[model samples]
Target: MNLTGWIVYNGYLPGTKFRDFAEWIQRAAANQGIRTTIYKNNHLLSCLTSDSVGLVDTETRPDFVVFLDKDIYLARQLELMGIRVFNHAEAIAASDDKIASYQVLAAHNFPVPKTVIAPKAFYNTGADTIDDYQKAVQLLGFPLIVKEAFGSFGEQVHLIHNQQELTDTIQQLQGRSFMMQEFIASSYGQDKRLHIVGNKVVAAMRRHSASDFRSNITTGGTMEAYQPTQEEERLAIATAKVIGADFAGVDLLIGPDGTPIICEINSNAHIRNLFDCTGINAADAMMAYIQQEMRHNHGRLADLP
Candidate 1:
């Protein structure tokens, strides 16, 4: 077998985004002469029995998997079965949750905006069990960001201008995990994206919006190919390395001084937008990285077991 693999994407999600991601990788794999099959995550059941772990009543396993969905248990199970997974389960877990990500970044001494994670509050818990959230205001001040910990495309992010909005946001987000962060006014309507593969940036872009504070391309923001500064490149690569992502799209916001600040890291970032703006196929870089790491050209999957 010449590096047979599976590219798995979420099945429940509508639209073509997930399918497109898989196709891109498949095309790149074909160029490398490696065969890869596209699979919907649900089609491959995460099998668990009394004494063994695998996909339940499934087809023959591949040598490796490029997982595009946030299925931590399924990913971990694959690893247990002697298959290599790029941007492994732990990387996805850390990147998927905003609160967890910030905690890790802060612990590693990365430059992130001042943020405060809300404490655990359940539906059954009384309001008295939760803090008044005056602490978040005191720490982050006015015009801050109230972002849900597990959202994408900036849909669940909010800008709170004062105490009233902060209180209302917390009340609305009650029983959910979220964070309060300092809003970088300078970065409003603009940010940078760097696609990192194996400790280096393969493609970069600047996303800008005229009417919104968040500069996410999926949310109607515009983009242009960008040449990252030496410092920006270093920071992006370092951020990806810290989370152990084999490939990632790292988003950075401009600080007041025009320096870069870590906004977030995306373990399974879509490459289509970057391709449209930069004419760079990050999928190629991804396949190449996988080949190098697996030593596929050398004809072995020794890294897995």
Candidate 2:
């Protein structure tokens, strides 16, 4: 069976790490004999228009759509058309929103840090008066993290240590919906990222950055192979299940008390690091998974006929 892969993102400009990784994924898929296609965000939008626009042609519609940086809005439309999409739209939307992700994980009894959600308007106004400042403090104490609702690769995360810093940061973030979470100093310098595909933990790594607090490899962090404890694995799996992602990268922070708290669940996880560090053929596994799903679906259709 022929399988088509799509990388959903805006056009990758040269010299960006994301572009490099995207190309690597494409090459890996090619080596596995999968016909891959890259569709940018604007291309997907243009696909819906009457101009017959976008990279996806009606005649060449793919069997599976692997969204890289694509929006979650296309889930239902594609699902109804019998396309197998990795990380369905609902899962993507939920995981993309930090507040929503935390809520889902917490509801499922997954350990996450104390978090507070604020409207963009409230945060933009800046808490000048003591009462306003107190309100903000009451929600999340000092040494907190402020993050935009939707961002990737650790681009929109900020750490605030005091009232003045907090105030200044808030003022700077005007007009953005953000979430605040209590910072766990214990996890200040290190964290583990577990890459899960289907029900298996294919590869894992621990990231540490001397110059940055965020352990995202894309953000100048150093990566090493990680073999997590049984407890950590369990927590990572639970977090993945809650997010409903077939492929996920679960970030777990070690709290002061040695508890592993779920920080974030990435639906469209980067597989390059896992491949580079652990020698796991994650792209091949992903392609195989898609082929299996396609065969299963085809069988179901035949039975119906």
Candidate 3:
């Protein structure tokens, strides 16, 4: 029997970008003869009762979900209903929070920049205390990076060159979870994005910006096809595995001596840019991986308790 899948994306996000991502995945699955449906995350209402977990989607149930949304609750809800979700909800939640992602990487002995997570602030509590700021400064030093735990497209990332700048940024991001990290001057305006599918690197690219510290394409950076060294490839694959992602975009920074250090892992990374840069359709690889997994585990996933 043919398998069906649901590509779930955020419904409330403005613009076509989020929806576009789902479509790309859907098309890739269609190319392989897998029937796929696009569902807005909000359309699937997660329902819970004292003794039951259920989701209300008017459409037919799918055998699996290609979850492209950051709505962790919705993802988990679908999982509870016995449908497999690629990139898993827990992985998505961890990847969505920069601090959580860093902690997971560090725990697994992955090479990462020195990082110090800010103390959680109560809501409407105003600015953070100066002592906490001083602690982070002492740990990470000046010219460090201040990044909100939950942000994307490098928009919430700030470069702090002094105590004043650090403190100012902290105040500006009051009541939000964030972190400070050592700046890798060697990778100031460039980084590599490796798209890992299953156990291997399917595509890679170098993103660089002449005018910005971040190399994210959303920030006007340019992309070029990249060849990953063995070390870079291993790090990318290991990081993705440790984070429990079936597929991921792992960003790597060059350390002082040219060693690769992980910058971040993106669980719901879009496939369009990787396709444009490397001429490799990551969505195709993802769909193929899913089909292989389903076949290998045929008549077994339903038996999973």
Better of 2 and 3 by lDDT: 3
1 versus 2: better lDDT goes to: 1
How much lDDT does candidate 3 score? 0.90
TM-score per candidate, in order?
0.95, 0.86, 0.96
lDDT score, candidate 1: 0.90
lDDT of 3 at 102: 92
- Highest TM-score: give the candidate number: 3
- The residue-level lDDT of candidate 3 at 234 comes to 94
RMSD of each: 2.2, 3.1, 1.8
Model 1 regions lying over 4 Å from their true place:
124-131, 296-305
> Which ranges of candidate 3 are over 4 A from the true structure?
57-59, 299-305
Candidate scoring better on TM-score of 2 and 3: 3
lDDT of each residue in 162-252, candidate 3, tens digit only: 8778767778887888888999999999999999999999999999999999999989999999999999999999999998999999999
Per-residue lDDT for 95-146 in model 2, tens only? 8888889888878777888877765464445545334456768777888898
Off by over 4 Å in 2: 12-16, 46-58, 74-76, 120-130
**Model 3: which ten-residue window has the lowest total lDDT?**
123-132
Which pairs of residues collide in model 1? none
Residue 37 deviation, candidate 1, in Å?
A: 0.6
